[model samples]
Target: MRRLLVLGAGTAGTMVVNRLRPRLPRDEWEITIVDQSEVHHYQPGYLFVPFGTYEPEEIVKPRRRLIKDGVRQLTGVIEEVVTDAHLVRLADGTELPYDQLVIATGTHPNPDETPGLAEPEAKQRGVHSFYTLEDAVALRDAMERFDGGRLVVNLIDLPIKCPVAPLEFAFLAEAWLRERGLRERTEVTYVTPLDGAFTKPLAARELGGMFDERGIALQPDFMLERVDLDEQQLVSYDEREVPFDLLVTVPLNMGAAYVARSGLGDELNHVKVDKHTFLADGHDDIFAIGDAANLPTSKAGSVAHFAVDVFVDNVLRHVEGLPMQERFDGHANCFIESGDGKAMLLDFNYETEPLLGSFPLPEIGPLKLLGESEANHLGKLAFRWIYWHLLLPGRPLPLATSMSMVGKRRPPAPSGNGSSTSPRDLQEVSL
Candidate 1:
């Protein structure tokens, strides 16, 4: 029997196995998945935890239970990959050989990479983040005690999972403060390394205007050097300081270390793979999907879901000695929580920047793009149910895998003196 080994039982790996198990002949194939933890988390829900929108238990489930019964599930730490011998080495010294391998270990926040973040005294000093379950729960308690003061939200680096999450947190926090009648005393500021509110000019301008209207200050182009615990300030590379009573930061994110040790990953420990096809640069039998691969797209679950649709077909064709016909276009869509029971949706691909339009249909969307609505907020909340029931199970969604321009249109041309530049004038930048 041919053995197929998968690393990490997260969203991408779990979906890949569930979708392929029924299609591949069980008598001829032995599929197995390995992960260090038995618990699977709804990562997006982490954004809601601190705001009391979700409890910790609401978004977690047993990893073993989620996998198909026909597929073997192994819980153990991966030490390294013996790529030449086609086997992965576990920390406990067990060796699992495979005819084919898929790495979906994903990326993680490494606070230690930045000075004063991972220090034992950081939490006590009011440094916190909602990136993990434990951290989110702790931040919830902190939010309860915060009456009024400087509440600063900052992003340390780019390419973090769910690039819009920090902005969402800012909007949610501002609304939460207002609801508690603490908005008058609280000074809310967002600090980022980028020159604008977001990477895309149109989105950034829209979001920046919202920040201004909401009384939240934007400190742009601030390259954070370190957290000054004693002074309770964020020190930048250019020697500017932003003092805060409470600091919520998104730490630097990097891929799993095993990929680096195995000599298959790039500088950030992400596996080097072809952008169109997930095949690793030097190996035919190996593939990397999700955040583990160096794809020029946002590291969001939507990207993972869409990429899996393309990857399954490509992998099957590749195993049969056929060229992969499916090419992923880095399709990604995200709901930006804009506070006050409303949110905005963004849809784009490798070739197109987010444009104003309806989604899933031209000018007929129940959902709107680059515009706020209560329906969009409901859609974002309703996705949690869909993720657990349909997405992870590899069932097809009504949405298409590739991005469509059917409903999308560029903004109206700027007309004042012909001096103002349009959003189209700004070059598109990718992850």
Candidate 2:
């Protein structure tokens, strides 16, 4: 049987095996997935852990349990990818040859990359991170003991998984403190390197307003230099410092080292792949998906799900010696929790920003885009179920893989006065 080897049984890899197993003839092709560990994490659930909404057990599952019946699963730490030899080397010196390869090893928190943000720093100061299950649980314990202080939610840098999570954490912490009658006593600040609350101006303005309304200060353009244990402050390279009594931070995010060693990665070690096709540069037989790929889009599970849909089709076409017909548009949808049983949905692709509108069905949607509502909150809560049951299984979702502008109201061109009269742009549309 022709070998179809996969590296990393994470979000993208597992779904690949599941979606393509039945499609690829078992007699002609054999599928195998490899990972360094047996444990699989429901990563998005990590966000709610600090608030005690989810437990570690609820978000953890065995990787093997998620794999399809026909696919073989192996546990091995990836050492390197020998593209010239068409083989993958493991830590134990075993080399697995592959006719076709898929790299799905996602990004991870690299605290060591930042000076004074490593183990010693965390141990000395009250530094905490909620990126991992253990980190989330630890942060929960830290938060439980935190009665009133400068609660800082800091993002060390950008291109992190679930980019909105820092904002979510700040919001949740505010609500949590308010619920405990400590809101007035505590000061919450969101420190981000980005210019505003988010990368996009429209969303940033909206979110920044929310922060102001909640009494949370936004410290934008604060590039972190180091964590100052003595002063209990986050010091930026420019000498600006944000002090904190309780520090919650997201350190530098980096891709797997194997990608770098294999010469398939950029400076950050994320695999260099075509943004649209996800095929590795100079290698048609190799592909990178999910956070492992150096795409211009957000490194999110939603993006992976959408991209996997297109990727599955493309992989089949390639295997059959046919041209890939589909192109991924970097479509992403983020459900932003605004606290107090309210959430907002933002849907956009590479070209368009999230517009305020009714989604899926115009004016009749159960979900609203770029606006806060109870219905959107319910949708966000319901997604956890869909993630486990549908998304991971590679089953069809009601949402379109490519972003649709059907329900959204675009901003009309400049109107009135000497302005080039046209419809208002989506940026001008109020939430």
Candidate 3:
């Protein structure tokens, strides 16, 4: 029997195993999944944890519960991937050989990349991050004690997981403080390296306005050079300083160290894969999906979900010696929580930027695009159920793998005076 080894049991890897389990002939193929941790985290829930909106118990589950019965589960630290030999070395010195390999190892925080950012004083003195479960729990404690002060949410660098999460945190914190009757005393600031609220033009415009409406200060283009725990401030490379009583930072995220040890990844340790097929370039019988794969798209759960849909079909085709029919189009969609029981949804692909309209269905969508509504917030809350049931189980979603542009409204043609027709068109445009 041929062996199919899947690395990491996160969102992408879990979906891959579940999607392929019933398709591959059990008599001829053996599937094995590897990860260092046995617990599965609902990463999206991390954003809500600090605000007491989601409990720790609600976001975690056993990895084994999500895996199929026949699939083998191996929990250990991966030392390296010997691509040429089709083998993987574990920290315990055991080696597993495979006929096909899938690398879904996700990214994690690299606080050490920034000097003094991970120091003990920073952790003890109200400096917190909500990327991990531990960070969320610590942040909750910090928030509970904070009566009123400068609460700064800073992004250390780009390419972090769930890029919109920091903004969401700022919005949620605003609402949280208001509920506590501390909005008048608390000063909330969102510090980002990007010139605006988001990478997308339309989103930046809409979200930027939301920040203004919620009385959240926007400090754009602040590239963090280092954190001054002594002064309780974040220093930018440009010499600009933002002081804070509570610091919530999104530190730099990097891929697993094994990818670097194997000489199989980029400087970031993210595997280089074909953007369309997710097949690892220059290596046969190897594929990568999720944040581990270096695709020019948002490193979010939705992107991983869409990639697995294409990857599963391609894997099935490869085993049958047939041409792979599916192709990943850099599809990504996200729901931006705008606080006050409202949220906004966005849908786009590699070739097209996010447009304004509706999602799931172009004209008749229950969710609006580039617009905030209570329904969108409901959709975000309902996703936890879908994640545990449909997403992890690799069931087909109602949405397409590739982003659909049917229901979106395109920017109006530029009129006279070097200005566009719509206010949203004036924002930054990226494809």
Candidate 4:
């Protein structure tokens, strides 16, 4: 039997297994997925946990239960992938040889990469994060105790799981404070290393306006040096200091270290994959998906879902020694939650940044793109159910695999302010 091994059982790996199980004949192929944890998390729900919108139980489920029949699920730590030998070494000294390998081991928050972040001193002084289930639960309690003062949402580094998550937290925190009569007393500030509110200028400008309207301050270009927990401040590398009453931080997001140990990664340790094909460089039988691949697009669940569709077809063709025709364009869409029961939708791809318009259907969308609407907010809220019921099951959604131009509008010429020069290097972080 041909061995098909998948690393990491997160969004990408699980979907890949589900999509491929039905196609590969049982007599010829044996599929296996490995993950360190049995519990699968709906990471998007982390944004709402602190605001009292979702309980911890709502976003979690057993990984083993999610896998379809005929696919094997392994639980253990991944130590290294010896590609030359076509072997994967688990922490327990077990070696599994694979005919085909899929690296879906996604990126993770590394707070220890930063100075004073994981230290006991920082924990005592109110520096917290909501990246994991435990972190989110801790932050929920902190948010409840936090009555007023400078509530700073900070990003230690970018390429985070959901790029807009920090922004979403700020908006939801603002709304939460307002509902409890603490908005006037609390000052919400967003600190990021980026130059603007977001990577896409059009969306950035619109989001920036929303931030201003909600009275949240945007402190850009903040290179986090260390959290002065004792001082209740975030000190930048350049010596700039931003004081905070409570710090909710997004730590440096790095790809799985095992990928680097196997010499299959870039500077960020993500697998060096063909941007259009997700095929791991120099390996015909290997591929990387989701945040594991160094795709020049958003590191989002949406990207994994859309890219997996094309990848599924390509995988079949590849096993048959047929050249792959289906190519994955860097398509990503995200819903930006704004305070006051409103949200904004952003849709874009490799050649196009998110433009202000309607989505799915041109001019007829109940959900406006790059513009705020209540329907967009509801759409965001409704995604939690769909993520588990449809997306994880590998069911098809009607959205275009590549970005559609039907409803989008080209930006009018820059108003002497050089708006057209917006940075395209920024990766959208969607969930």
Per-candidate TM equals: 0.95, 0.94, 0.94, 0.95
Query: Once model 3 is optimally superposed onto the true structure by TM-score, how far is the C-alpha of residue 377 displaced, in angstroms?
Result: 0.4
Q: Tell me the TM-score of model 1.
A: 0.95
**Model 2, span 171-265: residue lDDT tens:** 88898899999999999999999878999766776798899999999988899999888888899999998999899999788999999999999
lDDT of 1 by residue, 203-256 (tens): 887898889989999998899999999999999999999999889999988889
The reply for model 1, stretches above 4 Å from the true place, is 361-365, 416-431
Residue 423 error for model 3, in Å?
Answer: 19
Predicted candidate 3 versus true structure: per-residue lDDT over 268-298, tens digit per residue: 8999988999888898788989999889999
lDDT assessment of candidate 2 = 0.88
For model 2 the local lDDT of residue 410 reads: 53
Clashing pairs in 4: none
Q: Give candidate 1's error at residue 8 in angstroms.
A: 0.8
Candidate number of the best lDDT: 1
- Ten residues in a row with the worst lDDT in model 3? 422-431
lDDT of 2 at 325: 90
The TM-score-based order of candidates, best leading, equals 1, 4, 3, 2
Cα RMSD to the true fold for all candidates? 3.0, 4.2, 3.2, 4.0
Residue 36 lDDT (model 4):
98
lDDT of 1: 0.91
Descending-lDDT candidate ranking: 1, 3, 4, 2
lDDT score at residue 321, model 4, on the 0-100 scale: 91
